[model samples]
Target: MDRLARRLGLRTDPHIFFWSAGLMVVFLVLLLSFQQPIGDAFGAGREWITTNLGWFFILGVTSWLVFLIWVATSRYGNLRLGKDGDRPAYSNLSWFAMLFAGGIGTVLMFWGVAEPISHFASPPFAGVEPYSVEASQDAMGISLYHLGLHTWAIFTLPGLAFGYFIYRYDLPMRVSSVFYPFLKEKIHGPIGKTIDVFAVLGTLFGVAVSLGLGTSQINAGLTALTGVPDAVWPKVLIITTLTAVATASIVAGLDKGVRRLSNLNILMAVGLMLFVLIAGDTVFLLRQLIESIGIYAGDIVPLSFWNDSMAQFTDEGGWGWQAGWTVFYWAWTVTWAPFMGVFLARISRGRTIRQFVGGVLVAPAAFTLVWFVVFGWSAMEIDGIGGSGGPISAAVADSVPLAMFAFFDQFPAATLVSGIAVVVVALFFATSSDSASLVVDMLCSGDGEAGPVRQRVFWGLSEGLLAASLIVLGGEAGLAALQEVITVIGLPIFLLVFAMMFALIVGLRRERVPKPVEAPARHQTAEPRPAQESPPRAGSQT
Candidate 1:
C-alpha cells in the first residue's frame, strides 16, 4: 500500500477527491431516492437536446476528428510525447491492445452485431424502407460512422494534450495539467481542482453507464444460452461475478492483469470475427469489409454534416433515432475522453505525436470497421440477403442481447462460439472496470501514484452496484434513461476537450529546441602573435 501510494503521488488533494466522489455519491443517492422524478427529468432534458442540439453533437465530433487528423499531419507530427531520445513505455502491439480494450472493447462487443442489424430493420431517416438493400448499406455505413475515427478522435486529443503537457512540461498526470500552458501555476488553484474533479465525475459516470449497459447485455446472453431468467437477480449476479473478476485484475496491476486481458480480448475478438467469416460467407464478408470502407469514406463528408433537421417535422422518429443513438454515442465518447486520455497518456509516454495519433485513433477505428463488417455484413447476409430465412434479424428486432447468439446459431458449434462471446463480454467489462478505476484514481490522486489496491476494489464494486441499481430501478429502460443523464454530464467535458486542444497547441509551440554550438575561432592565439595588417572594404589606408 505504501509503495502504491508513492507511485500515485501519495498526496491527497481533498478538494478534488471530495468534489468528484461527493458528486457521484450524492447523485447515486438522489437517483435511488427519487427515481421517478430524476428519470423523468433526464428524459425531458434528453428530448430537448435531441430536438435542439443535435447539430452541436454532429458538428463537434466531426470537427474534432478533422482537427486531430490535421494535427497528426501538421508540422507538430514529429514531436515526441516525451523528450527526443525517449522510447515508448510499452511495445507497439501491447500498447494498441491495451488501448483498444480500454477505449471501446465493451462498446464494440455489445453493439457490433446489434447496431447494424437494428439500423437495417429501422432506417433512421425517412424514405428508406427497412431491410432493403439500400437500408443494409445505410446500416453498415451509419454503424461505421458511429464507431469510426470520429469517436476515437474524442479520446485521442485529450491523450495527446495530456501526454504532451504532462511529459514534456513535467506536469501532473491530471486533466488540469493540460491547462498548464495557458493557466500556468493556476493549475494548482481552485480552477485546476475543479477541472480534475469534473474529470473524475466524467470517468466515473461514463464507466458506470457502460457497466449498466454491459450487465444488461450479459443478462441477455445468459438467458439465451443457459435459460437463466432475465431478471434483476441474474443481472445483479452477472455484475457481481464480473466485478469480482475485475477486482482481481485490478489487484494484479496494469501489466500483469490489464495487458494480459487486453491481449486475450484482441485474440478472442479476432477468433470470433474469423469464426463468423469462415463459417458464414468468407468471400462475401471480405468484400463487404472493403466495400463498407469505401462506402463509409465516400459518405462520411455529407453524413458528418447531416443533422437530420428536415426529418424533424416530417418524421418524429427521425430526431428520436438521432438522439437515441448518434447523439448518445457522441456524448458517451466525449464523456469517456478524460479517462481514456489519462489511461492512454500513462502507457504512451515514449511515443511521438504522430505515433500516438495513429495508434490511438486510426488503428482502433480501422479494427472496428473490420469487426463491424464481419459481424454486421454476415448477419445481414444470413438473415436478409442469402435467402437463409434465418431468425437472426427477428431475434435482434425482439431483443438486442440475443443478436449475436442468433447469428452464432446460424453456424456450427453455436454453443461454443456463444460461450466464447459471453467470456469476451465479461472480460471486456472487467478491463473497463480496471482501466476506469486507474484513471479515476489518477484524477483524484492528482498524479500517477498507484494508490491503494483497496481503492480499486472499492471502485470496481461501486460500478457494479451502480449498474445493478440502474437495472433494478428500470431494467433496460432504466439503462436508457441513465444514458441521457450521462450525456447531460458529458456536456462539460465537451468544453474541456476543446480547451485542452488550444492548450496543447500553445504548449507545443513553446517547447524548447536545442541550439547548435558554434565552433571556436580557429588559431586565434597563433594569428594574434603574427599580427597585424589592416584592410579596408573598398580602399586600403596607410
Candidate 2:
C-alpha cells in the first residue's frame, strides 16, 4: 500500500486514505447499482435515528452551546490557541469572511428565504395561526434557532480542540488528535485511525449535501434565467462543472484559491443583502431584524428543549416535522462539524480561546440572522402573511431551489439580482467543495499539509461524483437520501463531538492550572535562598 501510494505520488496515511476512499467507493457502487434499496435503507436509517434519538440530538447540541458559553466565560478563555507570541494568520475582516463563507454560506443562500417562509406558512407551534404576525416571528426565530449559536457551538468545540492540540501540543492534525489527552500514545493506533475514518465519511456526506443543494439551486437559477429545464441532467452537469472549478481551487491551495473565493462570496452576499434591505421595505426589515433577534433570544431556551413529545397524540405529523427539520439540521450540522472544525482550526491559529469561541459563535450567526430577516421577511411581506398563493411560496413548496429567484422576481432588476444570486451560490458551492477537499486532504495526509495535486484533485472530484450520484439516484429522493445519510452518520459523529468536548475540557483544565515547580526543602536545599539574597520583608525597602 505504501509503495502504491508512493508510486502514485500520494503522501497520505494509508489507513485513512485507503479506508475512507474505499468505503466511499463501495457506498457509491451500492447507491448506483441498486438505487432503490440504498435509498430505502437510508430512509429507514433516518427514520430510526430521528425517532429514537431525536431528543438526544436536541439535548446534545444544546449542551454544546452551554458548554462553549461556559468555556468562553471561564478562566480557560484566556489561553491562546498557539504559542504565546503567535498572532492571527488573517486579519479580522478576512478571517470573518472566510469563517462565514466556509461555514454556512451555501446553506444560508439555499435556505435563507425558504426556511423562514416555510415556518411562517406552517407554524411549528400548534396554536399559532399560520401566516399571522406571531407565525412570522416564529418563522424567523426558528430559522435563527437552526442557524445560530447552536450550530456554531458544534463547530467551535471541535475547532477549539483541534487548534489547541495541533498548535499547542504539536499533535498531528487529525480528528483523533483531539483525544490525545485520553488516547495518549494510542492515538496512533487503530482506535485513532477509526475516528479519523469516521471523520472522513462524515465530511464526505456532509459536504455532499451542500454541494447537492448548491447544484440544485444553481440549476434552478439557470432554469429561471435561460428557460433551461430543471432536470437530472442539468444538475449533474452543474455538479460536474462546479466540481472542476473546485478541483482547480484545491490545487491552488488554501490561501491562493479558497481564501480569495471566500472573500468574494462574502462581498457578493453582503451586496445582495444590502440591495434587498435598501430596495425593499428597509424600515420594516430593520424593525423585523431587531424584533427577530428579541424573539429568538426569548424563545431560544424553550425551542432548544422542545422535542414535540405530545405531538404524537395531538398532531400526527408534528414529530415528523421536528424530525425532518430540526433533527435533520442538527444531524447535518454535526456531520459538517469535523469539516468546519478542521477548517476553523486551520484558520484560527494564534487566537485566544475566548476570542475564537466568541467570534465563531457570534459573527456568522449575526450575519445569518440579518440575512434571514432581509430575505425571509421580504418574501413573507410580498406573499402577504400566509403566502396567499404567492409565487415565492409556491416555488418554496414545489422546489426550494426556485424560492430565492421567485422572491427576487418581485423586485426591480430581477434579472440582474437573480444572476448575482446564482454567482453567489456557485462561488459558495466552489468554496465549500474546495474547503472540504482541503480538510479531507489534511485528514488523509496525517500532518495537515497539502499533499500531491493528484490527492487534492481526487478528493475534490470524488465529492462531485458522490453528489452527482445522489442526485441521479432519484432526483428529489436523492436529495432526501443525502439528508437521511447525514442524519444517520451524524449519530456517531454527534457522540464523537461530546467526547471531543470532554477531551477539550480536560486539556483546557491542564492548560489553565500551571504545574507546580518543586522547591528544595530547607534541610536539602543546595542553593536555595542564599543569605545575601534572602527575600525582602513585607514592609521593608530593598
Candidate 3:
C-alpha cells in the first residue's frame, strides 16, 4: 500500500489489501497442502474456542459499551473526532455509509429467512422444542439474540478506539492503534511488529468468511430469481460481475461509492420489509415481534451470561446445531467488526461518544427486532397457521427469491419487486465490498484516502475470487470451515480491540489537568503580554 500510495502521489501508509489477500492465500494453501499439520494445530482446540472465544464476544462488547458511556459523560465528551478548529473529518453522506453499511445493510441483506429457518430446526433457548412452533419462535429469537445490542455493542469499541486515536491523538486509526499507549515502546520494536502482523492476518481471514458467506447466498438469490444454474461458472460469473460494480463504488471512494451503496441498501431493505408486512400477515407479525422484543428485554442479561451450553453441546445434539448459527455468525460478524469499526470511525467524527454508541450499537438492534417480528413472524405464520404445508417452507428455504418472486408474481408489481431485489442485491453487495475495499486500502496504503484505485481493484477482484474459490474448492462445507476460521480469528481481534480501548481511555485521562480556574476578569488586568499572547487554557482537544 505504501509503495502504491507513493506511486500514485498520495499519502502513504500500510496497504491493507496485501496483508488481507496474503493471509487468505496462506490459509487456503495450508488447508490444501498441509491439511494435517493445520488441523493438528487449529482443529485440535475446539473447547478453548467454544468457551473462551465465546466469552471474548460477550466480554468485548460489554466492556465497549461501558467505556463509551464513561467517555461520553467524562471530560472526553467535549472533544470530538476532527482536528482542532477543523470541520468534522467526514460528511453526513460519508458518515451514514460508514455507519449503516455494517449493520443495517450488509449483514441483514439475506438474513430475513436464512437465519429463522436454520434456527427453527434448532435453537439456543434452553427448553424450546426443535421444529415445533415454539422452536420457530426460539429460532427467530436467536437471530434477535445475535443481531441486537450485543453484536452492535461489539462494533462500538473499535469505532471509539479508531476515532479517538486517529482524529484526536494523532495516531494511525488502524487496529494496531488501540494498543499504542500501552505498548508504544515495545510496539516500535519487533514485538509491536508481530502484533500488527497478527492484526492484519486476523482481519483478512475474518473478512474473507463474511464476503464468502454473503456472496454465496447472493449467488443463490440470483440463481433462484433468474434461470441461472447453481454451478461454478454461474457463481464465478456473478461474483466477477458484482466485484466490478463494487470496484466502481470503491473507485468513487467513500464519498461516492460506499455512501451511495448504503443509501440504496437501507432503502431497499425498508421496501422489502414493507412488502413482507403488507403482503403477508401484518397483524400477527406485529403482535409476535412486539411480544418478542418484550421477551428479549426481559431475557437479554441472562442470555448474555448463558455459558452453560458447554455440557449440552457435548451431551445433546446441540453441537451441530450451534456450530451452524451462533458460532458461525458470531465469528463472521466479530471478524468483520474491525473493518466496520474503522469505517464507523471515519464517519463518526463531529458526533459524541454517546451518539456513536447509541446509533451504531442501539439503533440497528431495534431494526432487527422488527424483521424478526414481521418477516420472521410472517414465515412462521405462513407455515404453521396460514394453512400452507411443506410448500411454503420449501419456498422459503429452497428459493427465497423465487418464493418472493412468486408472491409478487401474483401482484401487479412483479416488475417493481424484481427490480428492487436486483438493485438491493447489487447495492448490498456493493456496500459490503466497498467497505472491505476501504479497509483493504487502509491496510495497504496506511493512509486514509480510500487507499488507491488499483489496490481497490485488486482487493475487489480477490474478494470475488475468494468467494468463487470457496465455492469451487469444496462447496458449503469448505465455506463452513472458512467461516470457523473467521470466528477463531475474532478471538484475538477482540483482545486487540480491547487493548485499543484501554489505551484510549487511559491516554485520554492520563493528563494532569490543571485545577479549574475561575473565568478571567472582565478586563485583562495584569498579565497582558507584549504583542501577541494566546488565550488561557479552556479545554483539551486530544
Candidate 3 residue runs with Cα over 4 Å from true position: 1-11, 14-25, 28-48, 51-56, 66-78, 83-94, 130-133, 185-193, 313-321, 385-419, 476-479, 511-542
How would you encode candidate 1's per-residue C-alpha lDDT over 339-402 as one tens digit per residue?
9999999999878788899989889999999999998988888777524335877887677777
Off by over 4 Å in 2: 386-389, 512-542
Ranking by lDDT, best first? 2, 1, 3
lDDT of 1: 0.79
Please identify model 1 stretches exceeding 4 Å from their true place: 1-11, 386-390, 512-542
Tens-digit lDDT track of model 2 for 455-495? 88999999999989878886655457677878888899999
Worst-scoring 10-residue span by lDDT in model 2: 533-542
What's the CA RMSD for each of the models? Answer: 10.0, 7.9, 6.0
Candidate 3 lDDT by residue in tens digits, 1-542: 56664666543344333445567688667665764555445543444576446555555566666677677666455455544343455665545545766444645655665566556644556676656777775666567777777677667777777776666545555565556566554543455545655665665556555555555555655664676665556666767787888888888887777777777678667878888788876677777866897777776766566554565545653343445555556666666666777778877776755566666766677877886677666655555632333444565555433444433344346567655765676577767877876775574444566654776777677766665655555443545456445656666666676677768767566532223254322222332211232322211111
User: How many residue pairs clash in all the candidates, one count each?
Assistant: 6, 0, 13
Give model 2's TM-score versus the native structure: 0.93
